[model samples]
Target chain A: MELFTPDFGLIFWMFLSFAVLFFILWKFAWPAITKMIDQRAELIDKGVEYAQQARQDLDQAQAKAEEVMQEARRQQADILREADRVKTQIIEEARGEARQAAAKELDQAKLQIDQARKEAEQNIRDEVSAFALNIAQKVVRNQMSDTKAQTQLVDSLLDEIEKKN
Target chain B: MKRLTLIALLLISTLVSMSFPAAASTKGEDHGGEEKIDPKEIIFEHLGDRYGWEVPFCHHKSIPLPIIVFGSDGLHIFSSARVEHGKEYVDGGKIFRIAAEGDFKGKIVEIVDGEETRPFDISITKNVFALILTVIVVCLVLLPLRCYYRRKGYKAPRRWLGAVEALTAFIYDGVIKSTLKDKASKFAPYLLTVFYFIFVMNLMGLMVVFPGGANLTGNIAVTLVLAILTFLVTNIFGTKHYWKEIFWPDVPLWLKFPLPIMPIIEIFGVFTKPAALTVRLFANMMGGHMIVIVLTLLIFIFAQMGMAVAGGTAVISTMFSIFMLLIDVLVSFIQAYVFTMLSTIFISLAQENPHKEHGAAEAKH
Candidate 1:
């Protein structure tokens, strides 16, 4: 029974001692220890949060860069398509102009050839007439080297002229 | 591992055999019908509070402490050596003697003329000395820690500082943070003090080192005070909803209004919690100490019988004592953990918002 019994004086001393110890520790020891630990924990949490924010920022920048790159590619494709359209348009216009010029040149050449042929034919007709006239004169001269033929030709011409008159 | 085991086996067998011869030699000197060993006395003596620290395995006298007695007259102060192992001490009109074979047996009593009275003994007893030593040790350990933290600030703790820092962090993280949550920082200091105080006392009790063998935590009064403090801390800062949950729980109104049984039960629960805490710590430490002492006494009990019996039982009793001591070492740490863990839980429970929890439950339903 004595083994388990509690002494009043012992309890008092224990209480007083415990209270003193508790107060001393609570006031001094625990504050510094807990403060350091809390500061460290807060610092770590902040670091993790900063790292996560940085990662998110990097992802955003990467996505923005990708978007800009895509925009530039799209614009470049549009320019390339426009250039091809213009090239084809220019080529077609040039071909049409060349065809028109070629047709006009062909018409001019045909007209010139027709005029040259006509001139040559006229010249040939004049020469043939002149030659025929010379040949007739020669023949007349040769034949009318006989005056009678000449006189007869003239008289017949005169008689025909009188009859006509 | 194998070699170690073989060595241990050989050593044990040698000790066992050697004890037989030793017992035989002692037996030759013994007269017929030797008195039997009193295990109960030995165990009780080990567990009981003393005026001094007994240095085990030594023939020299125990280190005496101061004896302080507050009686009907006034305070009486003197060296415990004056009492001479509680035989008798006389000073003026006061008489002090060891009460034997009574309710106050093993206690120092005051004899006034013919009447016997127990003085209010607030002496520097073995347990008190140990507790004071523990406080000094705690301060010594924490002073260095406090300085290290002051110098280093937020840097990682190193060396002995690191070991202590780890223990502190473990308590903060495991007990305070887990239980107290938002209020963890507020209660951290108290929690740390409780943990270290209890743990140091328990470890000292197990080791039987300087201020170690004194079972301070095993004293019921000390534990009661500790529990009461926890009780006060919990109830004083208890939230409005904490009180509501106890008084008017989110149950049917009839239970609260008509019966009022729940509130009464809840009020009783408050005292029981701390009471349980007190008993749990005291019983565990006291029981562990008792078992170890009892196991040790078994060797002597057998030895008192005869040489053969003594030798045979020494090995078994010694083995049992060793085993019990090992368990005690583990128990000391465990009890410390349990006390701190429960304290944190109790304080946190008091701080809980019962209304919010009730609303959450209603939402779930």
Candidate 2:
């Protein structure tokens, strides 16, 4: 037997079936199916929108975290800078105090040295005056004993004093 | 305007020519002779022999069984048989001549002694009876189904509708909407009808073994008509965008330089696509059926060779037949889907709007 071939009979049946099928499908099937598909599409759209919103929220959270971290970093930097400034100021203050103390001690030592030097000079002057008085008394006794020798020595001493003045 | 006038003139001339009756060809006339003609032989003489178009693979044979037509004169019997290769044979080696008797009223016209005459008619073909039975079956099955769903106070079941809906949406969403965009919905009803019709016809093709072997979808004429319809729809609804994309595509300098040749090729492509769609579906369905027939024929061929070969060949043919049958079922459905999809795609392409988007975007810009 060869393969099948369509006759008028087959055509008629096919036509009848098609007509009935089209009518039934158009009336009942299309609406429900289209409605379901539409619903599915709506649900998908809503899901995508929700996902987008979630992404935006995540981005905002990330940005907020970054801002907080930057703020913390700034505060830490400021604290370190402030601590450095304070340390520099304290060191400068201490150096200034030390210099002032050193200067005051030097001045006191110089004043004490100047006072000792003046005392020593005054003692030497007193001794020289006492010795000169003893010498004069002795020379007067010798001049009475030996008038000629004393007159000659007194004249020589007077002539030398007159030349120096 | 010129072309239209010429076409109209040609059509009128053709009609006029058809109206002028020509002498009937003697090739169809039956002559009585002294030779005792077998009734079976006479029947086959009326029915034409099968002609194989694709040699050794595909063949087409149409048998016209004798039918009795009841006429006003009385009972007029008409032989549905045809002759081939100048030889008159009834059986034609393949088709069975079915006897029919019915009370059908019609005028009996016949030619005897080179003169027209009338006789009593009462014969119809079993083919006609089969056709009637098939129609009844379809009506009997489908009408009740329709009524049952209507009475349920609810829509038909989702799964049943789901298959249909999927096809509808696929055409609308995947093919039509993508191509036609705004105009797709308008053409949905027609596209849906085409899809379902093709699908059902294809399904019916699978039931060839049920009754008389009838593969409706495998017929080339039917497929050709469908192709013509698609061609008409596509051309009639063709938009500027369709033409622009085909004839004057935005190609680069080197390609665009051969403008005349390229445009002609592009135009040819337009015709070929729909042509391909038609031939592809028709050929696939026909080819699958042909293979099954060839495989079945192998058993007979092998039997003629030897008894041992016949036994082994029968077993192999049986297995092969089963395999082909399964494949044929799949091909039927796939071809139907391919046809529907291509039609929708073509229709949508024709209705597309090229500048609509650009215009809207320009406004925004």
Candidate 3:
């Protein structure tokens, strides 16, 4: 019976103490713990988001650098191609000028040679004509003494003319 | 490392076991003979409330507590030693004794006109003292967290405080938050407090020495009060739909008008949930205490046969008691966790949302 009977005083204390404990915990203890937990969770989430954002930004920057490098390489290739074209154009122009200069020099030499050859030919012709005239004068004085010698000279001259024709 | 910890745990429980014999011996000396080792009386004495604490390993010595009682005349305050060993102590011309026989046995009863009358007694019995100590301990352990959080501001707590946080979070995340969902924060304080409170008291009961061995959680009155509080919290915070479903369930209309069976069952269910909570915790702790007491009493019981049997039984009984104590510690944590888990589930049941039905339907596809 004693064990079966509920002790009222102890029950009162139990209720009182538990109520006080609950009130203390509800009003004081738990808010901070739960709040800090929430704050820590929130901070972790923010950190993860920041990391992902940074990774994305890094990827974008890397992609931009890759694009820039590609652009630079293309520009370098274009510059090299332009230089090769310019070098070929300059070589062609130099070859053309050298050929023109060589052609002009050859043309001047041919003209000078032609003029010298004409002057030499003219001198030879003048000398030959002068010698023939001197010979004709001498022959006329000697051949008048004899008619027979003059006819033979005329016939030989005609035969020479026929052979030249 | 694991094996080492187990060894160390067994060693510690052995130390706790040492006090069990000492306590039973002290009780054995009261009967003045080894043959009078009544297991029921010894176990009940250990499990039940007392006016004074039994000093460990000491005979005829108990730490007296303040005995405050409201008798027929008025209120009176005195030390428990005044009524020690069933001695009558006259206070304010009224005779009072720790009643040995009659209806109010093991309780302080007043002898008035040669009649035993129960007083409005609120003396700080062993259980009440232990309960107060538990409250203080809980307060001391938990109250500082508020300030610690205030100072730390989202940073992790230090050392043991971090361990404390882990335990709280386990219940919060594992039990309350999972069941309550978005409403977790609203109910976490009460639930968390209860978990820690019950856990601490359960652990305190395992030790047989001073400041322990109170058997507070095992007491029906205490568990009853705890259940009552849970009952109040559940119904008070119950949602509109919860009450509506209880009063007018979605069962057929004929069931409501003719029988009102659903509502009757629902109302009974509201009380049964807390009732089960009370019995579950009380019985588990009580049974655990009883088993260890019985196991230890085997030493004294077998001693009547012979020294050889007593020695062998002592060795075996000590080992089993140690094992049982270890199991009891685990059970202590489990019972606290279970109580909190059940309470959270119950509150969540009461907190059921009207929109969840649609969500449940949508989830199937």
The TM-score leader among the candidates is 3
Measured with C-alpha atoms, the lDDT of residue A137 in candidate 3 is 85
lDDT of 1 by residue, B91-196 (tens): 6678887677566676677887677788888888888888888787888777688888788777898889999988888888887997778899888887788888
Question: Clashing residue pairs, candidate 3?
Answer: none
DockQ, model 2, C-alpha based? 0.03
* Tens-place lDDT digits, model 3, residues A9-115: 99999888888898988888888788777778789999999999999999999999999999999999999999999999999999999999999999999999999
* Residue B170, model 1, lDDT: 85
True contacts kept of 2: 0.03
TM-score of every candidate relative to the true structure: 0.74, 0.46, 0.81
Candidate 3 per-residue lDDT over residues B1-365, each given as its tens digit: 99997787667645544554556556767778664766778788888898999897664679999888999999999999889988999987999998886767788999999999988899998889999889998888877777888886777887878888888878888888888889999989889988988998999999889888899889888888888888988999998988987899778998888889989998998999999999999999999999999988887787666656666677678778888999999999999999999898788777776877554334324
- Ranking the candidates on TM-score from highest down gives 3, 1, 2
Worst 10 residues of 2 chain A by lDDT: A1-10
Ten contiguous residues minimizing lDDT sum, candidate 1 chain A: A1-10
Docking class of 3: acceptable
For each candidate in turn, the interface RMSD (Å) is 1.3, 7.5, 1.4
Ordered list by lDDT, greatest first? 3, 1, 2
- State each model's CA lDDT, in order: 0.81, 0.55, 0.85
Location of the lowest summed lDDT over 10 successive residues in candidate 3 chain A: A1-10
